[model samples]
Target: MASPKSAAIAALRRQLMMGDGLSPSPAPQVTRLGIAAIDAVLPWGGLPGGAIHEVTGPENDGAATGFCTTLLARLSAGTRPVLWVTAHDDLYAPGLAAFGLSPERLIVVRARRAAETFWTIEEALRCRSLAAVLGEVRGPSRTVARRLQLVARSSGVTAVLLRHDEDDAFANAITRWHVVSARRDDAAEDDSDARWRVDLVRCRGRIHGEEGYVARWFVEWRAATGDFGVVADLRDRPDRPAPARMAR
Candidate 1:
């Protein structure tokens, strides 16, 4: 059954394919949320680069805007522009400032309903300049989420969808989280060490930190990964040992 010439050609073809194009590859770069413990816990050091990260919660609990603002602040602090597409309009501007975000850096879009909000999110995710794109949306069809997943894969930025309701949204997301303000550890001197509990209800790959609950804060970060639970005042993080130099 074996012809010498045919066998030789087949072997050559296999070698060419293997040498030039048959090698498989994973995601280009998978960086974490850049939060200390969070990145440490994630498999690729972060959520898959182009993956949908679901933030689900009850009504407006500051969980939606708050998490997005802080995550973006961390990113922008590292030199990335954030695009926030929300239905809240101007009501969210001052709140964003409280999280150390410059409204100027935010590209805010007003969506009338949940569906429109998701549409805008997918479009911006396709853009290269944005560091992260956050959208306040509710349960989206599985097809839409899968499509968004593709856009996320192509763009390194995280596509964070704030699911307004938990029932369907949580069920369908690759990763779903319910964020709430955890009790403040005021036993310490300063109160700026506010912490929130990020509950990772579901994630496709390995994630670090405790799943039931994880503590994080409003403090300035010196390192890409800080002790999220250490209760250190923003003033004390070693990265910025000196008193904060606030800009006017």
Candidate 2:
């Protein structure tokens, strides 16, 4: 039998999912990444919608952009537009079509300085009509990160911060991921399908002691299927024995 207090809490959670009683309907409780390997490890069974997530990659590596854009496609899979704020205008719009993000639904904001970038991101996050807001900055202070996290939580907007290769400042985001490009196992020359080696360097609510306990995966985005999935398990690859390093 369910205890009274437990049942009430469950009821409240259900109501929140339905966007009634306490939370607004515009924001869903969670946005499943749709990748089983990654989603299963997340505390919420998916990326927390109304929170901030940070992604970084090696300097000049194109993998980070690919991974983030694919993620944004999943995060903003609705009628609401996605806001992308950055100081640079190097993002190629046509490349995004392959990732399922239409250029029409993406609103780009060019900021002249880092402060302007963060300010614009903060303001965009507060808008309920936006499905997600992505900010590209070189570095941000911990204080600014905290402010962004708090605002995302309050407004129920998914926030993504993309850091350049050299910028590795600490942040208060729920999850911090490091991405790098990986070659396909088949050794194909074409770039039709892309692979990535992703590392979860920090997760806010990760279990203690197990902070070091981790596993890495080779994630792939299949253009044919339009989804992301684990292409190879780094720990145990089909072509090789148990290895400490990924088959990059």
Candidate 3:
């Protein structure tokens, strides 16, 4: 049973998908984050498929990459391969494997220029063969964002933009996320686990009070299971103390 707020957001998303004189497509399947509280807030009960989402972090922050890799691992659970486009050749296959995304399931494309990167992402989104497309881009224009969104919708492929730029110029993305490294006091003891403070900065079709639609969570990624566990929900109480370990 969908909550009233969830239903409303779904309706709004449908309306937006139907705009620009394009015929309505069937509702897309969602990928749950495996965290109940996080899932509950999402309009589709999870991250919506056939839509474009953005993730960002401070310069040189690997937490954002870790977060996106986890998402890709989930999205590419099936036989369909995922396409990753980036200008820099910095993606480590071993590190990605630790996050549960195998190199065999990935197709990497090296585009030296921004234009080439965007073009590759758009083309990959149009291919129904891909389960998802991730592009490491910075400061994409509004026009490029819309074009990618439309293509992803038509092809039913999820698109994720991993950005390091602070520009918030893209209004067409369905969601925007900001991720940063979270420090734990016993960090040396649990060096294998990656902790992050994830902020849902923008969500289309979701309404909130003066605080806007922002939500924050402290999450820990367990290397053994390659899964995320909630450390704490900081939305309503930012100062709330996190548990010594993530909730199982």
C-alpha root-mean-square deviation, candidate 2: 6.4
- Give the candidate order by descending TM-score: 3, 2, 1
In order, what lDDT does every prediction score? 0.59, 0.73, 0.78
For candidate 1, lDDT tens digit of each residue in 120-201? Answer: 8888989978877888776777777777766766665677777667665433344566776545545565344346556555
Q: Which candidate leads the pack in TM-score?
A: 3
- Compose the digit string of candidate 3's lDDT tens values, residues 69-180: 8889888984679999978888999999998888999999999999999999999999998989999998878788778878887888999899998876367777788899
In model 3, the runs with Cα more than 4 Å from the true position are 1-13, 16-23, 187-192, 208-213, 233-248
Alpha carbon lDDT at 1, candidate 1: 83
Model 2, 21-102: lDDT tens digits are 1124454467788888777776557877887788888758888888788778888885568999977788888888778888
For all candidates, the clash counts are: 4, 0, 0
Worst 10 residues of 3 by lDDT: 239-248
TM-score, one value per model: 0.66, 0.78, 0.84
Residue 124 alpha-carbon offset, candidate 3, angstroms: 0.5
Candidate 1: give the clashing pairs: 32-46, 36-225, 41-208, 50-152
